[model samples]
Target chain A: MANEKRVISVIVMNESSVLARITSMFAARGYNIESLTVAPIPDSDMSHITIATNGSSKVMEQITKQLHKLIPVYKVIEHEEMVEKEMVLAKFPIAENLADISVLASAYNGGVVNVGKEMIIVMAADEPKRVKHFIEAAQRYNPCEIIRGGVVAIER
Target chain B: MQMSGAQMVCEAIIAEGVKTVFGYPGGAIMHVYDEIYKQDGFEHILNRHEQAAVHAADGYARATGEVGVAMVTSGPGFTNAVTGLATAYMDSIPLVVISGQVPLSLIGTDGFQEIDAVGISRPCTKHNFLVRSIEELPRILKEAFYLARTGRPGPVLVDIPKDITVETGEFKYPESVNIPSYKPTYKGNKKQIVKAVEAIKNAKKPLLYIGGGAVLSDAYKLIREMAEKTKIPVVETLMARGVMGHDHPQLLGMLGMHGNYASNMAMSETDLIISLGARFDDRVTGKLSEFAKYADIIHVDIDPANIAKLVDVQYPIVGDVKQVLEEMLPLLEGVDPDRYQAWREILKRYDELHPQSYIDSDEVIKPQWAIERLGELVGEDAIITSDVGQHQMWAAQHYPFDRPRQWINSGGLGTMGFGFPAAIGAKKAHPEKTVINITGDGSILMNMQELVTAAEYDIPVINVILNNHFLGMVRQWQTFFYEKRYSETDLTFQPNWKALAEACGGIGYDVTTKEEFDAALKDAIKQNKVCFMNVSVNRFENVLPMVPAGGALFNMMLPSPELADSALEDKKGTK
Candidate 1:
């Protein structure tokens, strides 16, 4: 098998040296992390980092094993049985014939499209993979610009 | 309806999603207690001491992967929590510790029960607050929970003056925390991630040195795959045991101080050390400056402060271990299979040569035999919690843990009284799994109070004291370093362990010989009650296949060729 991907959720202390220590560790180690998202947790002094990475089972095992060694690390967790969700927003040129695609945006967990004078914007919230798929599917629509948000997860 | 400040705090706690709080009640916290009675839905587990409460909370947090909440009162109540709170800080268990300070007007006056809870707990807690107003209650409560559970989570303390709870404000829980200085980096830098890939592709002998970070990052699967695909051998620190299947051929076992001779030797030989999530603790590195002298180290971790702290690194990837691994997976091109052939061969030679030899000549009871049989009989999956001593080292050396978090010890803190309570916590965490506390006699007695905690909770964590009737580790140092002064090492005060267990409301047994141990363990495993077995042997028994403190991994104490020959000759002569 090539490799499997793992979804890791990091609850971190947001600090100046914090991000540098974590990323440098990853880069220096040569472990491949696939998806990365960092956002402050709701109503707290910490940030939750959700990362998606692909590796052989052993490599991934080595990765999580190392996470425990970091000093600033509070708790390193990966959701075995969790509910993961991601969101995305895309702005398509109004002239690109996106008027009929409003329903497509809602098909994903997104809706409430805003039509402005210069551009048309659509937003979707869905599973991370599905959102990735939506972004790929929306690519042919001649998107004037696209922005994808990182994933957020909570345990079931 | 009138309510105590303590009661309001409890209600707010319940509202904040806490179902359990571990603490002991005292005069300073009497008001808090008044409120605790009015509260429902949240379970309040009364620990024997404030320390136990914090430890239990930590245990709960680790097992449940949620922020653990603990509460205590000022003075001794606050002081007693230091060990457990520090334990959490060291181990990175997320906890929200709520302490009751003296009434606001009496705060600095050092009232009879007053102590500077915040100042006292400064080094241990991630962040702390002394609430001055009732208006700050909701935000403080909200912030406490937020602080405990978020970025690089650690224990956070919120000290509430008794009066603040009496005061009230509109309870507004903020939707998001806006701390300008605190931002955790989750994603690895695109440029660094790319450079790491290139390094891996080019390195001749790329090895993965794993620590607890891999499990913390939840990248076990990714780690395993990366190892198998790249065929990178893994060297796990003692803390990282069970992050991967021990049976994995690529795994080289625990590395560092008492690490396998082969693994340490390999570290000297390997070109690149791909360290993820693990720090360069002294135990893992004989001397920090001399560690992995042969390797160009690559470190990947979610905590930015850990990178290049101990060892200078060629590349540092700061992001969650899981995230960093995903990015490097595809970029790694296949390296030659035989790249590490010579190193692997040498390691295999060391493994075959050393073979963890032990002195079996003595017909009397031996410590190594007991540990080996227990390890074999209990099976590799049995959770082995140990107190600090020679036995802890022996267990770490001999036992094979094929599960993550299975081997729980007081690794960084080296707390002696850790095993029994930790076993209790771990048992509570994984009730189905067989939890065993392998402690030295000296260490076991330190927290023997928790015997009642286990009995009260009906938590049957098997307590196996490697009883040597002395502080074995200390005594060993006396024997080895202090020139046999033996000083305060003896444990003459120990009551008959079997009788002691029965008095404490548990089953008890004793084993004197290996044969008796084999027979006793069969029934011991099935016993429905908490049990203690006094496996008696000579007090002089020592764990061999030894590495002395601050010594090189390769030098000394492996059955000196003459020692091995004499042992065989002595056995033949005895026969």
Candidate 2:
């Protein structure tokens, strides 16, 4: 069987050496991390780091343990059971029928936020994988801007 | 400690250690340029063309591993930089080409030089930006530099409008970048590393397949150490040529269409394959389904999607080569080889069956011999650039390099005018190093304006034109594949070599014979000016190991077996 992948969330001081040290761990030891996400904690001084890596359960546990040991790490949680969502805001041409775009957006938990004289801004929040599909389908409307927000997850 | 976004961008670039920039000035970018002029650290090389500016920056980046920097005005200036930016992006080189945009007040109202630079470069760049305010310039520039230099390195363009550059407020460059979805994996899995180690230990015949990643990630030393420890033979891809010492006892030389017999034999026989840093391009693996059926392959790379895209990968490690090797090194401390005695014998037999050797014809000086002489004289260390043609094929076939960046060519882009400008750029990047631009008469003529750049810089780049009086590769295509009805391949005439060089303010020589070529090359290397040698060659020279359009590597047009036989017959007839 293939190794299981772990998604570990790291809370840390939003500082320089933290990212450098974290990446240096990967670079120096040659450890392969599958996916990584980092964002500031809204109004807090700390940043939230979400790292996804494939390994056995033991290795996953060890990884989380080691991450917690790092100097800047404030919290480490393995997202074994979580409701994860990702957001993507796309600006499509105003020429596309508004009704069709609204229907597409609402279905993905989104809607048209604004309709300037020349442009339409549509924001969508969905499962990360589904967000990719939404972006792919939205290509028909001829998107001018695509801004993908960091994935945020909370344990189910 | 604090400034506006525009000031932050400047500070970030300074931190990145960029010493020079090439750009064309304009009104839209006056704010940034004003900040630039006020700064006292770096000088900008003003280019006559925006496209040339980006190309020079790209050339600088490829020549030096440092990120190449360029700036251009809005709209058309940005568009011109796009082509050069795309070129660097496609080749996976680190470049930062910043462009100016119209002010926010004039952004949507058909402002002058206000093309949507970010939108235009979306597909061409790793990442790009349009700063809405001066407050974020520091963060954006820091992120741009980080993104440009990380993972599979490529171009990143930051488009700042004039007003934002002038707007000032509290500013501080971010200490770190936090892009959520763009994490690149490094380091091999311990289990897979063990599996690979066990496979290597058990395989009767194991081969360590090398690729350009070795050179790019600076994994040559580790790869060498691993090969030595495991006693495995090494076969390099086109880009992986100089990653290992070619003369190593375990090195089987290059693999793929024109790969040496030893390399091909090793690939065909080995039961275990460890691909370090190469994408198995079709040129290397002829028929994917039928490629190395005997082998259990392990592919280690940074791009995850590339894992099982082609052939079946038994063990896939997605990570940076340098990081992966560093982790896997200690695991291979004392590994011992267990098999391959009989397989080596069979490879030796294949080596005897399909040997590679050059021919001597009394009538025409062979192109292959010239390349061999170039390799022998220049040694493998000189930076060699080639224009896309049959000569490119011959050089790939003959020249042996063991590192990544030592040999520069337009592989993915296969651009015609690449050699001249690229050589000048490489020379400019490393003024102390010897840069050789090898081109066909047709290919060299494509971007011959760069001869001015070489001359203006007073950079002595040796331009060796394999002048066959026709677009050699195209003519060869017509000869064998297209039924030999040579159409526009033939070129009628031009000024003599000395005259052309004199016209261009450089040194040039017309070499009609091998003796003339040897003497001219020696003198050309010693000259102070950019030297161009137009070597007159027999028009019918063809590159063997030809993979027709979409064919596999194994299916090659072997070198004409008739040359040797015809030579013997010619001697007999003369007698």
Candidate 3:
């Protein structure tokens, strides 16, 4: 079977060790996690976890099933028709072309978030695939550093 | 009412209806031990080692179908119990292990006897918790018990810091657990049951592949009913022993590595395999691609993760085995047993042609014969626990077990020291029944200290050591696959087992002849004290009918050349 990139969202009880319980399971089972994001849901004692991974469909099925077996996991969604977003922060030297960088950031639904004496940091929030593209496109400005946040997904 | 967290722990245990606990106490858990001393409802067995305590609790759970409980202290204490936890986890035995942790303030300061108990046990335990405060004690205890016994049934650990154990808290044990995220599917899909029934009715060579889940679910009766009703042959995994009587016509005996020829052959030839609560473990499914190749599988398990995890199934039912069988049984009423009559005859023929046997000798005792004799003497009601080795296989093959929980062993983890401690636990569970630990010479020494625990507790469990003077299982493998290099396999430099038992305040018998063994066993039973019968047997004995590690089930290495030739002919004839 061919490896395919997939996104899975898990709703779990907000507990001190719930994240450890999940991430360890992925590690123990040899499942690759490309990116992972966890945050508490609003007005609830449960947390939402989104994991981006690449694996065969068979392995993905097993992973989903194994995730459900965790005591704190409330629900697992291997999104089919869903909206996903990733955030990336890129720092560039102040000497770089500001107009070109702003235009590139705008194209990826982003803008200049901060401007410091030696560096300019541009933040981009877009579809995870497009975020990757935006990172590649901004490399022309001699970026100092790049910090990419994990994928956060929701169902359509 | 305000109570110490220790008091609440005791109260919670009482509310959970746990009558017995196995544990070893230390500094961090001293408060709980103090409470345990003051408690009136439950009895605690003080084990010599934390690992043995966990195994004993696991043995109790496996025998009684109740959530076994064990308590240990921090750091080394918790580390010692990890093997037992993993053993129960692999076999899906329900267990609640309580471990002490350093005070909250000292948790990361490398306090005396402190360890990351929860973090270390995460992969092994079904679930684990680190008690943050005394207030969460009651709920966490309740949840620990609930999670351990429910769903697929596995070991759950609760790491309690010393400060929390000392702090005051309001105790209110919940009437029921309501973990919104942890609901297990108990009722299988109705549509899948109908499909399974259709498959059962159409299959001319159906085999019931039963595993530890069937034993855990307490579904032996239902499994037997389904097999007998459908006239399908049953093949039990190591953990599923006694789900069907050894003498039952439909039982082809245990399948997999050390399985009988008939069972392995039937597994290979079956047209339909109705796997009940079985995970189709690699041991049972030698060479996954070739396993049950001709069969359309209908798997029923409570854990959805187990279904089709390895091999794709034609029909899958996710639920408790008993419930799924209950749903499938009624639909199976009209099925004719005559449909599989021919298939049963073929398996029966295979069984007769290559029956599990060993050469009889007057001077030297055969391990298989010794087990058979033990079975005859102990009767069918005896609860037999075994450590992993050649002895375990012999016991499983020769013992006449006719009920669930009668045969207890570490099937999934294959822990060497499991037998004696487990036997102690089994005996504790049912003091009236004859409990025996059938262990090999090498395996017995691993936890022989438990003999003292048995003596101290006055729990009369017989430890029958099949002394072959070698780590027999590993030696057998070396003999076949490694040209008998025998590196570290020879165990000739061993202590006197008989004297060791006697020194531990237990009766000891060193028997070489068959008559001596019989007499010693009878006398040991009459003594009603912890007894260890060191029976010397032929040293070269090997567990036959093995499908060498990754080999196909049909390609078994039988004991004799004639049997192998016939098996080859049989395979050719089938083709």
Candidate 4:
């Protein structure tokens, strides 16, 4: 049950300490968050936040309800059907086979976005699950560094 | 219409219909206190400590069903009120604490009497605000009131910086708040309500498990109607002590750790449980896996998170308890009552077999006897508050509370010093009603300084001290669980409470016998001013019918052999 991942998007008033209030609630309840991201919405005094956590249906329900209780939180959306994405950038040594890395990244709807003298930078923007798998598959190319962005979600 | 933050606070409080606030003043909060001094129509009860102020405010809120307000300074002042805030938070009482903070610039620089007021109080509060500007003071204050008193009420805190309190800003108290996410669901889902009603009607053994939520939501009348219409037996949790009259045939006494035997047994045997506003707390549920193992639970609570948090709720109705009960009552009419009669008879037999009785000794006064006698004199309608311990359990067991809010105790947090200050708050809210604080030796000393507050303010709340000269509850636990290694539970060096009360300008009495107790209690009630009565009780006595921690509710430990013999003798005499 703990392995089942849940994605929840919270719309909140863009204010100081608002994020603390929401995150503290989850911490107080001892809920674990796997990945989180927050950014201000365009042309509004609000922010969009996405949290990925592992819990059963019951824990997810509790997390959602508690999030709704926070003052700054305008809405809590537990995605039943949604388009979610995570970005990962992997830098591989230039001497490593570039053709094989491109094929592996392309399989996950991703490809090399940059080619440098010292390293080849590959970017993958796909489902969080696939992005996770892509990182595991590209680990063999002697990747110098890997950066994983937090999950960002939108309702379909 | 420009005003300082302090003045706007006063304005917002007035606009929010807050006529009274319990608080203590200090350097950090001087501006607000100064404003309070200049303002009219607000009664401020200055308590000895910040902790007691919050407790008094909590007591006021619980007794009056209004949002109680408490104000204090920064740093140590806010930290001192942490226990009171936690108590109110656990019990879901509506309270607002306004604290002073260091000026915005010195917030993180470690200035004099500065602490992270909001951060320290975050976990214990339902929500909190740290005022960064004077312009937002009015809105924050308004929101604080709304949040504290709204659905599943809990405490909220507002921390104001010293500079903000002095800075002037345009004061426009909003006529209404627009928190779209904070709306509480009042109307229960129709499908769930119907399903719960059907389950109740068809079940052979149905029980109504009432909690503090039922009392807070004022669902007593609706609960009674549902019980009578459906012929279902009802059992209450500690917080829902007076859900039904003590003499009601269908009303089983409280269930759980210190609950009545028959009620606990009935809970184990029930086929369906109609839970109203009561969370399945550890104390109430005992062993989680063993709690109501055979029954299908129908949970009706306003907080969606509360549903199925512990027990698997078969029918979850997310709404206010009162509104849900109102909607479910009509659906329960004309339900066949024959099936429940047999279950009722079985429960009646269980009650008859093990009546809740305690040892009555003629040589020494017993705590149970003192409480029973006190109940007779005070009557069921009198408001009673209790500190946590053996005395609290005795009071809950012996006192017959006939109305909602009549019996107020620190249920969830079980804070020891909660009784006296809370009784002061209750008495202040209901000036004509008699308010009694049933306290113990250890608990009375926790916040005994509040006696000066009562004496100064002319709040005539009766303090009944069951002086056993030991921390009775811990002593009992040590005796049972720790192999009689009584660590630091002994409290023989306690102060002379009677002399202390007298020194504080309150009348005091020392009673050792039942006759003396009766006389002293009557005298205290008649005096009409602040009075404290110290009733000496047997130091070794333990609360009977106690369910050991993690023990099944149905499997309760009864009185020991010596006490059992005394109880039998007393029963024979009564017969």
Q: Best candidate, DockQ-wise?
A: 3
Backbone clashes, candidate 1: 94
TM-score of every model versus the real structure: 0.74, 0.75, 0.97, 0.95
**RMSD in order of candidates:** 17.5, 10.2, 3.7, 3.4
- Model 2, B236-265: lDDT tens digits are 887777677656767766777667666765
Q: What is the DockQ of each candidate?
A: 0.02, 0.04, 0.92, 0.63
- A best-first ranking of the candidates according to their TM-score comes to 3, 4, 2, 1
lDDT of 3 by residue, B36-94 (tens): 99979999998899999999999999999999999999999999999999999999999
Residue lDDT tens for model 1, A40-135: 878887888888787866566567755644445567786778888888889887787665568778889787478898789999998888988888
> Candidate 4, residues A13-119: lDDT per residue as tens digits?
99888888878888889999899999999999999999999888878888888888776889889997999999989999999999999998888888999998888
Candidate that beats the other on TM-score, 1 or 2, i.e. the better one: 2
- The CAPRI class of candidate 1 is incorrect
Task: TM-score chain B for all models.
Answer: 0.91, 0.89, 0.97, 0.97
lDDT of 3: 0.90
* lDDT of candidate 1 at residue A3, scale 0 to 100: 91
Who is ahead in TM-score, 1 or 4?
A: 4
**lDDT order of candidates, best first?**
3, 4, 2, 1
Which wins on lDDT, candidate 1 or candidate 4?
A: 4
Off by over 4 Å in 1: A1-156, B1-8, B11-19, B333-338, B518-525, B543-547, B553-556, B559-575
In the range B538-562, model 1's lDDT, one tens digit per residue, is 5665555445666655543565433
Q: Candidate 3, residue B91: CA error in Å?
A: 0.9
